[model samples]
Target: MAGERVSLDDALSNVDVLDDLPLSDQQPMVEAQSCSVVYTANFDTNFEDRNAYVTGIAKYMEEAATHAELNKLLEEGEQHAVMLYTWRCCSRAIPQPKSNEQPNRVEIYEKTVKVLSEEVKKLTKFMKFQHKAIEVFCNQVKRLCHQEKRKDFVSEAYLLTLGKFINMFAVLDELKNMKSSVKNDYSTYRRAAQFLKVLSDTQSLQESQNLSMFLATQNKVRDSLKEKLQTIGAHEELLCEVVNISVHMFENKMYLTPKEKQMLVKVMGFGLFLIDSDGCNINKLDQKKKIRIDKIDKIFKNLEVVPLFGDMQIAPFNYIKRSKNFDAKLWPLCSASTISPQASLMCHLPRIREEHIKYISDLARYSNEVITTYKETARTDAENRDISDLAQRGLMLLSDWTSVVTEVYSWKLLHPTDHHANKTCPIDAEEYERATRYNYSPDEKFGLIEVIAMIKGLQVLMARMEIVFLDSIRKNIYQELQDFVQLTLRDPLRKAVKNKKELLRSILVSVRETSADWIKGYEPSEDPALKGKKDPDQGGFEIKVRRRNVGSEELELSLYVPPGPSSTQLYMVRTMLESLISDKSGGKKTLRKEMDGQHLVLIDEFHKTSFIWSYLLNFSGRHAPCPCNFPNWHGHVRRTTCLYPNRHGHVRRTTCDVPRACTLTGTGMCDVPRTCTLTGTGMCDVPRTCTLTGMGTCDVPRTCTLTGTGMCDVPVPVP
Candidate 1:
């Protein structure tokens, strides 16, 4: 997963920042991530003004071509479909109520129906507009293609006709998705609310028996929707299949294949005659007397499953990126048979191609640089910075080209909805001042072509930066982890030796499996060395075993006596002096201490015979951080001095001011300095907290848990 390309899902997951957010914040976090710039890129509907208008036109025309001379008929179809769906769903949610169920189920259902119907009316208006636009666009194409050179114009005319179907496919797909997914459309709130009302308290709801009945009701209402959807899905699938064929024909040199080459030659010649020229060859009129522009629609209707477009051999794409242009040579299958007046406009079509490409690329580059500057503050480490700016800056188009892109994509431009009344850019109010300085004028920076370029640039930049960020992050993580591995790996014999008595007083070890001699060392309570004497006689000695490290093994010597601080030195002393044995069987370790709250712990169990220089002097030369995080952990392991003068002078030796304190571990007890007001207790792990004095020993479990809700969710013992 770390090595694989970051998908939209992964990027969004990180935006949610799963680990940092509380469970309660999960839903909102997900919503926020979806609302972020990355998610907005996936939503193609948010087009600029010019593009949206164009797309709107394209959409309505396609809907028109589907019907004959219908103004509101297609829209009515959309309304009927949505209304039936809404009513059925609400009606099912409130089953007959059995005469004893919820009192106002019917009233609630009826109100829901009314609300849903009201919403459908508004939604249908967009659909109706979309239908009209589609029809108008087709009509425009029909008029544009009436050509004197019909054969030459056929390809250009066919491309636009082809786009009509593509646009329809895109619009309808978006509509279907919004209708089904609640995550996409918040307008589905009513239906979601009804669902929640019935399935409320999912964790402990009492309607377990009625679950199946509820499901059945949902199925009953959704059955019609499902059928309508399946039909649409089939059509979309076919539409996509056709679009893929068109794209291949347009892009990959449609005449490369011998058969396709023959088709293009014939189509061009036939198109020229059908436009405005009188027919020279009678053979061109095979199916009809005249090759007509409207006949192009018939080709789509009965498109043969000829293996010409699909499932054919193709050239490798390796050099395609470096190639100068998209091989635009193509056989216009739509115009393969006919030409008309509409085909005549190809000669008039402006050669604004390069201008459009440049506009898109330039806008993409600038946007990426902007997003990059914003992100750099968050990416603090210079070592972490690399070739992760946005994607390849897209080409810059002219204002006109930008407008075209926006219009074609059906996105709203950065302009007011009523562009005719007020020629103003509808930039976010907060950024208006900055935008003006950035050369984004209030009026001129819009329309179909320009808006399209901006959107195209935005999408390219969004995907590009995301790719770059993830790629750089992957490399950074790999290097850091490798360096960590290299640190210990450089030395074959050296291993990390952590002293436990200084940290928590308990030890752990991992060693290799093949070594005969145990290489075990412990922190000296006093002496610097003696290779950490292992006296077999002293019961401190336990079994020896082998452990593994970096695939190598060394014998590990562990002293494990039965549970009772068998892990501590006190247990060893008890084992030696059988006479002092008292059954405090399995009692939790407690560190009882008293202090004026000024003295610090040095070390315990100093094996040195010298008392004065045993601990304090040993650590005198070490560096102490200005604000040492570990107050209890003295810097050095050899020396420990807890000056509890009130008790005994020996340190690491438990001293109890409570009359009788065991001189275990041969260490000093708690120190009572100049003031006799301080009471001193022995040091241990689970020592009870003193309520009156507010002081405790720093042994056993060392962490101080903060009380109350804001603290970590570390589980507490029930007792």
Candidate 2:
């Protein structure tokens, strides 16, 4: 029995684990065991009865051996049996069909990906349902291990497999929780999207028909509101004007009056009310709010709703004004008043207008400081430098300015200039050609043109400002005169002067003369009387120099000249203009050399000159000779004496000059000539001897053939 136990131990120890073997090799071992069972069952065979006896014995012995081995495994080391069974049942890879084909890399890759994809697709579901299966398996293993028949079972492989199953169950529970959270998020998001879609489909007014209907409804409502406001008397009449005034006053640190407040309440319509400083309701209106203008005025006039505190403190601008002793800031706490729970707190909050005003002023001050620094820097850099140096400095300034502007533009507060939009100059062909003659980078050229346009716009703005200032002054003076006539002196004649038709012309004339004189010093380079071909009502300057050929169409040149402070810059600009006017390309090039790199600057400084030319042009007639080419405007001398037409209707003749400079015989008068239908006789009245002398100097000879009698001073002729 000891030897047999030793032999059994050795055989069991010699038994090899086939866990890692391929199914092809493993299947043969199982077949061998079955074949041994068949051989043992068939040990006794009686030919005919052998088959039946073998089958019955083989089935009984196979069942008995399996049961007995299982019992032994459980009593000894059930963990090893469980591990081996679990590996075969659950963890083993699926077996491929038996074939002699070698593994293809492509097919292997495809198969591996397919398997992995399937596993990933079901991983979430697997993790969810796997915990229960793992738990059951662990419990069964524990039961087997703790069983009275197999309590001592211990296998390292089985222990390791059990631990892995336990760990997998724990990880699967955590995974299940994660999947549940993800599902919950997805569901919530879907529900929210569904709600939003439903709401938008039902309530959105962006559809064309809906938008039109809404707009029509809004118009009707606005009309009704305006009619209601109009029926409200003085409040209605002053509402629009007062709203603007109040807002302006508000910006300037002034509080709104009752009228202004009432107007705002009516116009703004909702989400507003008047309140006292103490968190108390001075007045409240329904959500469909309206206030009687008279009531507002009365409330302020009567000085209602005073608090307990006195006037030792300065009241906030947003707070209601109170009587002297009740104007204190702490009055809200001391006073007993009706409180509101639902009112907007902002409506009752005191606004320190002075504080806001100070803040705005500070911003303005800072902006002005920056502007001053820029101006100073630009001016200083430009001073004492040649054109090239100035241009380099200006380039630096432009770089800085561009950076600053880029930042400002990025803020999206204002639209930037579209350099490509309508990128062409409105000038004559020659002028356009001249402007484009200088080669420059596209960016530089565009910038130069845009800056020139901006400079023009700036000048226009300044001119407008000047005109407004002048108009204001005139109006003020006129008002003063009317006041003097109506109020102070009470002179009826002067009052008549205001309304009388006859005096109207004189008054206008006086006003015009006064205005002219007032702005004389501030006048630009042009005379206002002849400012441009454009009408006075148009209110801008334009200059054009045209040359008219006698039989051809007129050629034109538009000019834009900007003004500058520097004399040298101004001189260079003047030189360029003179050259342009004289049609001398050489002169232009000379000036260009002198003002190198300062083309933009020089051109901008000619605004005043252009304005002057435009002004002078306005006084001239359409048929007038072009100023650019005065006498030889048509490329030739049109006249020898007078540039314009004279009284004689000839270009050369004046009123005093006669057509004939000399009569017959070429003297001032026809003395020696004899031609007379009036005399009724034709004769050579001169002496024959004097005729002998052929000299026609005085029609007399110094020494002649006929008479040499000291040579008669008068001419002698013979016929």
Candidate 3:
């Protein structure tokens, strides 16, 4: 007979007779009974174990075993179930009544049924928690599944959780109703509760055994969730109820892959379209339901956290392409696909476009902050005449551009109007020309387009700053180091020179001696001996040696010379004087005190020669001695003390004359030749008709024979 439904109150009132109904009326089918058996035996719902349990029960029911064998299987299975349940209840600290003999089979079955009933009821507790677990798993797969580092682990965990869910649904589908034995929804709770009312601690057994089985499954699921989180490098707090995870759960749970998220958002929009399909001003379904734009905006604003499908290397130029020329040339560095189909679909949505614009606005604001900060820092650095900090900050900005461009590419793709590329606001040609100077239109200076250009410009500008400013600083430091080294070496060099002063003076003396040796017998090109003839046209030449002269009309000659200080002695003295003067200390005065007479003579000669020849020429004229008599024309020189006008216009004493002076007087007294004597002014003694016109003796001895006519004796006899 089929069991009839009875109220829980009536069953409680008649608890003693609850098992009096026909046994066949409440027997669960083979699968349900086997599920309870396996659950009680091992608490394992793995496929192989569940299958073996069901298959064995089916074989027994199909009579594959004898009647005795079937009876033995049932007895053994009931005893095992009772033992396990009793142990579980004891472990939980639940009290149990003492039993002397083995409990009746009916009593065991009733207790087992109560345990399964509690297990089923407690499973309800995990419904909300299981749903959250599934949601969390889905988000991890969607968000982290595509990451290069996370793909393998996250995918494995995702499929694992998905398989668990599928198996759970399959088990729920195969469960049989307790009374019908044909699968139908059944209340294992009421049947177990009425049958177990006879026992004092049945509620305790129910709580311990039922809740344990339920918690076992959920704990496994939580472990799987923990594994998945770990695989994605999530923090430990993210696996728990930390603030970041809580906020993340609320805000980011809907972050699917770009394609799935795009489809989901579109489906939601379509659903709204259907709800408002009639375009009717329908009466309020509930008076409290007012459309809250703020709430809607808040929900939509949270969507900004979602990663967009803007993985393009360069922004789309579609809008500007039709109105003007545009091109995109940048290549993506990241491995994400350049084009996503769902992203293309989302690009057409008005709401998506608006969201993207808002995102672009955010990017623009952030980039402006970066630009303004960099400009200020650079300006301050320039003012302080320090570029070390400037170069560092510029490099930081350059490195930051990679992420900035990534964000800009995403937003610029979703933007509907390429206003930056095709702007025509200022119609004036001059304005357009001016705007192009900065490589952008004036209107584009603060928005997305300018922001994009600004990032690129900043990269270039920062690189140049690093090169120019840093290099200049390096050069300046190098130059300063060189100068410091030179200055540091100066004192040592001066000390070394001072230490070698004696050796240097010896070298100077040696050099002077060698120079004198070379000059001793050396003939100069301007020596008077090399001057062949002073007058080229005449057969005779005038030689003005001191005061010497020779034969008149043949070769007039007069000579005079004076011997002065030797040149070698003069050179050595001059060299010593130079060394003394060059010595910076008080060596000059000491050297002057040590001078002897020869040093004084050389110094005096040098001072006398310092005047020009014209100034001393009058000395030769005024102080020259008269000519020596002929036949005594040997060279003689007089030490002429000449009076010459000094620079002060007073007569000053001078010992110098012409470099080679003559002894002839200014009168013609020395012009005539000497007649007979070799000495000066000696005249011939004979009258006319003698070869020696004025000699005292005749050239022909006694030829005149006392004839005073000064003719030969033969000419006198002939007359």
Candidate 4:
């Protein structure tokens, strides 16, 4: 009654809709609403309580009221109320505690990778277990690795490391090829690794970064990486390239230390010593893994990069020398081995023999070319240049051949000089040195000064034996014999002569005379013994001088004469030899210059009595010394000199004083030297006896022994 009245604006909008229904029609609507709630207890209604908690019918209006806030507070309020009502219905009005859980992908991934690594380790070690275990483990990890990011990391780590395990085991043969199902192995690991890299690139560990989506796969993918690795058949050839490419890397100040460089010497040099080429040479072995392991062992001699194992002591040379192990195992693959006196020299050398042979042949050809170029270049002078300045180009040719010489020297070291002589064995230092001079032993020095001292002694020997231990130097002075020397020393070289033995006699470098490079300036106070000092003189040369006015330079080149097993002093002995040679050839004489000066220390085609001083010189680049074609090495030298004693404790030459020189067939005179005391046996016809004093002797006693001790305390043989 007080406010039935409406404002004019509302009255116009409602049109006082009550106007039509108000008096008569509205009477039942108003009367029913007023009486409805009077029986609420009987109606069993919770609507009022629910409405008290919920928002109004006009949600937008309520939202508008709280528009200043960012969150939709009204909607949230309604949701909370609805949740409370539902909780009350289902949970009997008991309040539930809020969960404190969050997604933990980090722990999930780490655990998966760890488990996978452990499993793969077991596989590598050949541990037997249900293959199902690995499968189940992977499945469990991937299932929980629900997040795309986690699956990628786990799969990648599993595949790559596991693949490495497979390769290693394949080498060791712990796991044979099997019939196990790999529908998941290939698809899960290999593909996961491939894809995970992409994912890691796109998204990093930062929490702000978005994770890539991951899709579960039921299909398997085939990986062919190993196939590609296997397709590389010419392994030795490729490795040679690797060596050639990496050689300068170490040589060009790139090595951090000296030991690294030293290690390379063994690695590269040893490889060349054994065979001609690098890979599938292992197929020539009992097992391919052994060669790889051997190579790995060589690499570790440098102390860089973690090694899988330690120093392996093997009787490496036995197999190469005579074991026949490799040939038996790899005969089908054409694998064979050669040996030398030095142990461990040819062990595991060339990976592929055939390939290596071809490589060496190529190197040898290049070396020959260099030798030819040197000949062409050295003869042409600038003023009288022959064929487009050949002389100007000769020095370059010489350097090239020198390299070839070094390569050939390496090969000779692998294959030592063969025995053509039947000389008596030489006495060791303990036997000979103690009796003559102070006792000494060989030892390597560590300091650079000491090392340089070693070089000095070697240089002296090189100077004395210019034609023997020749340096790889090209000069127009020795042009006549240069090409011959190179041809002898190239990779595929001729036979190694007992040059060092003869060299020792010529330079006077006996076991007793050497000490810390002292030989360079050494002058023997007492002359070296010859034939037990019976002669009191080994050999001597008369020196001569030659003065030739070459282009008005007044050049003087001296020459010296050769004295077999003589001359106590080696200092400048080479010069003495040359001085004697020039005078013998009837050259000009100079008074002031000593006749002992030598321009060249050695020469071939020497007089017959001088065969002890001659050595054929040939050179090359690869470590394969082929046989020499000696123009003067007639069959007579072999037949006649078979009884002559060489420096290596064996008889080398049978011809004495032009015995075979006069005629190709030797007069079959048995003039072999008697090394033992006479015992009235048919073994020797020469009259000799054994005694310690001054090479003197007594009649052969019934009880006397020839020992290294030079005593006759016991009988060596019954008389």
- All-Cα superposition RMSD per candidate: 41.4, 58.2, 65.8, 50.3
- lDDT tens per residue, model 4, 637-689: 32222232223435333222221222111222222222233333222222233
Q: Candidate 3 on 167-278: residue-level lDDT in tens? A: 2321221121111211111133333344565334866566545444433343344334334444443222122112112123224432211322322322221112112212
Could you give candidate 2's per-residue lDDT for residues 1-719 as a string of tens digits?
55655566676656654445557431111010011221111111112221222212232233233333333433323232222122111101212223436455334334434433333323323322333343343343434334241322222222322333322232232233322322332233223333335225544323323323322242222232223333332222122222233333323322212222222222221111111112322232211232232333332222222111110111121122332223323334323343221111122112222322343454345335444655311211122122222222222222222222222212111121222423452233232122222222345344433333322332232222332222222233223222322222212222323445233223222322222212123323452322212224665443221111111232221111111112212122233233322212322132223322343243334322232221111111111111111111111112222122223334332221112212242423221224322222332221233234443312223343223444322223333
Candidate 1, 1-719: lDDT as tens digits: 67889889889989889778667421211000122332211111111222222212232224323323232343444453443233222222222333537787666555544444544444444334444554553344344333422221122223423443332323232334333322212234334345446436764243322322322233222232223323221222222223334444433433212223223322222222222112222223323433332333333312211111111111112111122231212224332444322212122124354443554465456446646666412232232323322121221112223223222211111221433333453344223222222223332333222333333443344434453344333333323323322221112112112221221111111111110122243322332112223334555433322212112132121121111111112212212111112111122421112111111111111111111111111111111111111111111111222221222223343321122111231222211111111222211112233333444532222222332333121112212
What is the TM-score ranking, best to worst?
1, 4, 3, 2
Candidate 2 TM-score over all chains jointly: 0.14
lDDT of predicted model 4: 0.25
The CA lDDT at 652 in model 3 is 44
Model 4 stretches with alpha carbons more than 4 Å out: 1-229, 232-456, 460-474, 477-550, 553-719
Ranked by lDDT, top first = 3, 1, 2, 4
Tell me the TM-score of each prediction against the true structure. Answer: 0.20, 0.14, 0.15, 0.16
Report how far off residue 328 is in candidate 4 (Å): 4.5
Q: Model 4, residue 228: displacement in angstroms?
A: 5.0
Instruction: Give the top-scoring candidate (lDDT).
Output: 3
Give the alpha-carbon lDDT of every model. Answer: 0.28, 0.27, 0.30, 0.25
Candidate 1, lDDT over the whole model? 0.28
